[model samples]
Target: MVRSATTAEFRADLHAWLDVHEAELAPTYRGMGTLDEQIAQMQRVKAILYEADWMRYGWPERVGGLGGAAALRTELGASLAARDLMDPGHFSLVEVLAPTLIDFATPALAAEVVPSLLNGSEMWCQGFSEPETGSDLSSLRCRAVAEGDPSTATQWIINGQKVWTSLAHFSDRCVLLTRTGPPDSKHLGITAFFVDMDTPGITVRPIEMINGVREFAEVFFDDVVVSTDRILGSVNGGWAVAMSILPFERSSCFWQRIAYLYQRLQALTRLSEPTDRNAEIIGNAFLELHALRTRSRSTQHRLAAGATLGAETSIDKVLVAAGEHAVYNAARRLLHNTITLDDTVHGEQWRTEYLYSRSATIYGGTAEIQRNIIARRLLNLGDER
Candidate 1:
C-alpha cells in the first residue's frame, strides 16, 4: 500500500535527514574528474540513500520500495541536485527508465531488477536513438524477430544499431526498442526489451563529444538472443512503453535539472562582479531560471496528483533549453577574457559547461521539435508532422 505525507511534513523530515547525512552523501570527486568518476560518485550516493531508505520511498513494494507518493522521490532527486551531490543528467536516466520497467515488466522481473537499479548495484541505458532515428523514433529499424516453436519457450533474435545511447558502456542492461514488423509498420510493430549489455553479439563503442568526454556510445546488436521474459510489454506493443517513459523524462527529470541549473545560476551570480551593462543580461538569465522553476513545479504537482503528462511537456523542455543556454551564455559574458583563454580549473570548468550547454537544444528532442509540439498540441495551431 502507498503512504502519504503532507508536503510540509515530508520537507521537514527530508531536510533533517539531509542535514545529518550531508557529509556522507557529498560528492567526493576531485577537480576535473571524468564522466566515469562522476558516475561512480552517483553510485556511492545512491547506495547510501537506498540503504537509508530515502532512495526506496515513492516506489512500489513489489519493486522493494516503501510505497510513498512519487513526489518524495522527485524531491529527493531535486535535493541532491541542489546540493551538488550528483550529476542531474545521470540521475535523471533512472527517473526516465525505471518506472517503465516497473509498470511493464512482469512482477517477478520488476521485483528482481528494480532493486538492483535503486541501490545503484547496476546502471541501465535507454536504446531508443539510432543513427537515423533521433526524433522520429517510431521509424526505428533495429530488428528483433521471434524464432522457435509456438508452444515451447521462444527466443528473440535482434539486429541493427543504436547511437547516442548515454552511458551504454557502463550500463549493465539496456531497455531496447526494435522493429518487429515490416518497415511501414512504424509504431505498431515496434517492441521493447530489457537485455543484458554483456549478451553475445552486442558491441558498444563510446562516442567522444566536443568537450572531450565519452558519455554516450554506439551500440550494435547482431543476432542477439533474448528470452521471452525479456520483453517489457506485449509483443509489438512496445510503443506504449516508449511513450510512457517520456513524461517522466521530461517532467521529473526536468525538475531535478532545473534545481541544478538554479544552483549554478546562483553560484554564477555570487562569483560574478556584474558591470552596469551586463546587469540586464544577468537579470534576464535569472528570470529564465525562475520561470523554469515555476513551470516545472506545476508539472511536478500534476505528476504527484496522478495526471498523465503528454506532449505538452515539450514546454518544459523548451524552457529548460532556454534557461540552460541563458545561464551559460551569462557565464561567458561575465567571465569574458578569462573564460575564453584561461586554462585554470575554474576557467576550464566554465568552458566545459559552456560547451556542454550547446547540446541542451538537441538532447531529449530538439528545440525545433519542441516548438512544433507546443504549437500543435498545446496551442492547437495545427498538426505538425
Candidate 2:
C-alpha cells in the first residue's frame, strides 16, 4: 500500500509542481464564455493534472487513482481555483458525484467508469431535481420500472423529466433518480441509476441562465432502456444514495468555491478605491468568506476522518450561499457604473457573476430548505413540514 502524504507535505509538493507547470495549465480564455467552452477548458486542465498524477491522488486505487488522503484532492481543487484555471462549480462536480459512485456502484462498474470522470475523459450530470421536485427530492416523479419480472429483469425502462440538471446537455452520463414504486411512495420508492446520455429516448435541452450561459438543462426520458447493472444501489434505496451525495455537495464541494470567492474578493478590492464605505463592504464580505472557509474546513476534516456527515452540513451550505451572495453583492456595489454600463471584459465578468450569485441560494439545496434542516434536524427545533 502507498503511504499517503500529509496535508502539509502535499501542499508543498503541489505548490512546487504548479509553479513548474503554471504556463501550461493557465486558461486561454479571458472571461466567461459559453458553457461548452468552459467545460472543454476544464477537461483540458484535468487531463494535464491527471497525466501528472495530481488528479489521481486522494482517490481509491480501485477507481484508477493513486490512493492518498482525501485532503489532497481538496487542496488540489483550491490550487486550481486560486489560479482561475477551472470554474470551481464545474470542477467540483466530480467531488459531488464520484464518491457516491464509489460507495454504491458495483466494484466492476466503478472501476470501469470512474477513471474516465477522474481524468476528465467524460462528464456526468446529476439528474436529481425535476420540474416539480427541486428541494423536495423525495417527491421526484421520474419513473424507472423493470421491463420484465422483477426477479429476472435484465433492463429497466425510464420515463420522466428532470429540470435544472446542471451541464446535462454536455454530460456523457447521469446519476439519475427515478420513482420505482407507487406515486405515493415518495422517498421510499425512489431508485438511482447511472444512465448513459446516448441511451435511446433520452433528450437534453439547454436552459440559458441570466448570465447568458447555458449552464443547465432539462432532460427527458421516454422509454429509455438501461441495463439493470446500472442501478446505483439496491432498488428503492436511492434516498440513501442521494443522502450520501448531499453531505459531499454541501461540504467537500464548497472548498473550491470558497477559494474562488476569495480570489474574486481580492479582485474586487483591487478594482475599488480605498474608501470607508468600500472598506466596510469588503470587510463584511471577507468575514463571511472566512466563516464559510472555517466551517467548510471542519467538514472536510470530518470527511477525511471517515465520519458519516448528516444534517450538520446544512450549516456549511447556508454559509456558502451567504458568502457567495455577499462577495458578488460587494462587487456589484463597489464596481459602480462599470458593472451596470461598461461592456469591457472586467465589467461583463462582474455583471455575469453578480447575476449568477442570485442563484447561490437556490442551488445545492435552497437556503430556506437548508435553514429548515438546520432547525429541525440539527437543532431539534421543529418539524420541517
Candidate 3:
C-alpha cells in the first residue's frame, strides 16, 4: 500500500480491498445515522485506511505519508463516497485543513499532529467566522494578544467567539484566526493559532441544522492561553493562511463531493419511475454533475502539478453548489411526494439530503460571494461595491 501506484491502480486496488472489507466498512445504521454515528463511521473508515497505508499515499513523507501523487488520496475518497461508505463533505475536510497546517505550522507541530488527523485519532475545526463575521472574515473580532516580550512571547491570550464552526464540539483542536494588529488593519491584523480544544477557557455550544443535525457549533474563547509554539505562520500573517486554505476548501473538498453527487444521481435514476420527464430531469442533472466533475478534475490536476490556486477556485465552489442543487432537485421532483410524505428509510434519506442541498449556496462561502470573487479577481473587474 505504501509503494508507488498510479491513480487508476490505486482506485482498482482500493475497490478490491473494499470488496473484501465491505462488511466491516459499511455503516451499521441505515439512511445517514445521527451525527455521532456519522462521525464514528468516518473515523472508523479513516483508521482502517490509515492502517492499510492507503490514506498516507498522497501525503508528504515528512508527515507520515508515503509520498506519491495527491490524486491517490482524492481517488481513495471518491471510491469511498461512490460506494456510500461515508459523507464526502466532512471526510474531505482533511484536504482543507491538513495541508495548511503542514505548510504553516512549525515542522515539529505538523510532524507531531498530522498523522493523528489522517488516521482519525483526532478531529480539528477551522475557527474563522465570528458571531458578527460569517463570510466577511476580515472583519472578525476575535483577538489574541501576546502575553510576554513582544519579540519572544511565550504565550498568547485569546478572547472572543466563533460561530458556525463545523464539528467544533467534537474537535480535538482548532485552527484559529485572531486579530493581532491594530483594530483597523483588517486582514493584515489577523494571526492564526493551533489551539487544543480542552484548553481551560474554551466553551462549545452545538447548533442544530435545518436537517436536525448538530454538525456546527458556537465556540467561546475566554482568556484562552496558547503557547507561542502554536502560532501557525508569521504574526499578523493569518490572512495569507486563511487565503491559502480556501483553495482546498473550495476545490479539494469537492473532489469527493463530485463523486457523491454522481452517486446520488445514480440512486435517483434507479429509484424513480422511468418516463420522458424523468429521463429529461435525470439527464439534465447528469449534465450538471459532469460539468462539476470536469472542473474538479482540472482543479485536481492543477493541485498535483504544483499550481498556486487562487480566485480561479471560486468557479469550483460555484459548480459544487449548483451541481448539488441540481441533483437533489431532481430527487425531489422525481421522487414526487415520497420524500415529503413517506416515513420509510429511503424517504427520510432523500428528504434529509434534499433539505441539506438547499444550503449549498451558502456554506464554504456563498454563491453570490463566489461570483464576486470571480468577477473582481479573476476577471479584473472593479469591486461590486
Candidate 4:
C-alpha cells in the first residue's frame, strides 16, 4: 500500500523506522576506512531506503519513483544525515547528478539507468571540470567527433582528458560534456553524453588531495565511442542541458547539506572546551548556518513549486560554501591541536574535512565566480567575465 503521508506523518514514520534500523545502519569502520567500504556502506543504506520507497519520492514514476512532493526526498536525505547513516558530502553526488539525467537523458535511458544509481547498484560521476577549465567550464578541450556509418548510423568518438572528476575511479558511468566545435566554440557547440566508464580506451587514475584521501580522480578518454542515442538533449544544445543542471546542484542539494552541517555544529558545540573564544566561534558558525538554512528553505520551496532557478541560485551556492567553511573553521578554532598535530582517528576526520573545506570555494563553482554571477546577473551591476 502506498502511504501518502503528510510531512509530519512521514517524519514520524521515518523516525520509527530509524529507531529500529539504527544498529544496521551504524558505520562499522571508523576513521580512514577504505573507500570501498564507505561505498559499500552507502549502497547498503541506499538499498534499505529504496526498499522503503523513501528514495523514490520526489523522483518521477517513470524512473522507479513514487511521485510525491520533492520535499519528501529532501526530508529523507536530512533524516539520513541527522541519524549519521551516511556521509552527507559523498551522498550529495546523487542530488547533483540524478536530476541532470532525468531532465536530459532520453526517457528510455532514464528508465534504464536511473534505477541503478538510485538503488546503488551503479554509481555515476560528473565530468565538468578539466585542468584548465575548472571555473571556466565552457572552455573545456575534450573533443568529440561525429563518426559511424553515414547512411543509417550516428555516433561520436570522444578523445580528451578530464581532471577533478569526483568519484570517477569508482563510477560505473559518467555524465560527460565534450567539445564538438572549433576551439573558440565556447559553450555553443559543446555536447553532453552518458558514457560507460568501462568502455574501451577509458582510463581513471585517482588524484590524491591534500588530505591524503583520493576522493577525486583524473579520467582519460581515447576514442571512446558513444551512440547518438546517448547524446543528452541535442548535439549543440548541451549548453541548455548543462545550465539546467545547476539548480538541483545549488538548491535541493544545499538544503540536505545544511541539515548535516547543523548536526555537526551542534556536535562541535558539545565537544568544545570551556572558553569565551570557543563560544564565539561556535556562535558565529551557528549564525552562518542559520542564514544558509533560511536561504536554502526558499530555494527548496521554489524547486518544489516547479520554478526554474537561474543566476540567483548562485547566492545559495555562496552561502553554502561560506557556511561550510565557517563550520569547519570553528572546528579548527575550538579543536586546535587535535585537528592540526594529533594523529588520532577523530583528529584525522576533522583534519581531512578541514582540508576538503578549502575546496568548498573551488568546487561547484568558485567563490569568486559565484560573487561575479550575483553582481552581474542578480544585482544588475557591471558586467563580469
TM-score of each: 0.95, 0.97, 0.97, 0.96
Compared with the true structure, all predictions reach lDDT values of 0.88, 0.90, 0.89, 0.85
Q: lDDT, candidate 4, residue 339?
A: 92
Write down the TM-score for model 1: 0.95
Clashing pairs in 4: none
Model 1 has a clash total of 0
Q: Could you give the candidate ranking by lDDT, starting with the highest?
A: 2, 3, 1, 4
- Lowest lDDT sum, 10 consecutive residues, model 4, at 147-156
RMSD of each: 2.1, 1.6, 1.3, 1.7
Kindly report which residue pairs in candidate 2 clash with one another: none
lDDT of 2 at 75: 88
Instruction: Give the per-residue lDDT digits (tens) of candidate 3, residues 48-156.
Output: 9899888898899999999888788888888899899999988987888998999999998999999999999999999989888977899988999999774699999
Which tens-of-lDDT digit does each residue in 1-385 have in candidate 2?
A: 1334788988888888899989998877778655677899899989988988899998999999998777888889988999888899999999999999999999999999999998889999999999999988899999998988865799999999999999998899999999998998999999999999999999999999988888899999999999999999889999999988876787767998999999999989998899999999999999999999999998988987788888888899899999999998898888878779989877888888899999988998899988998888888898645
Question: Which residue segments of model 2 deviate by more than 4 Å?
Answer: 1-4
* Displacement of the residue 77 alpha carbon in candidate 4, Å: 1.1
Error of 1 at 225 (Å): 0.5
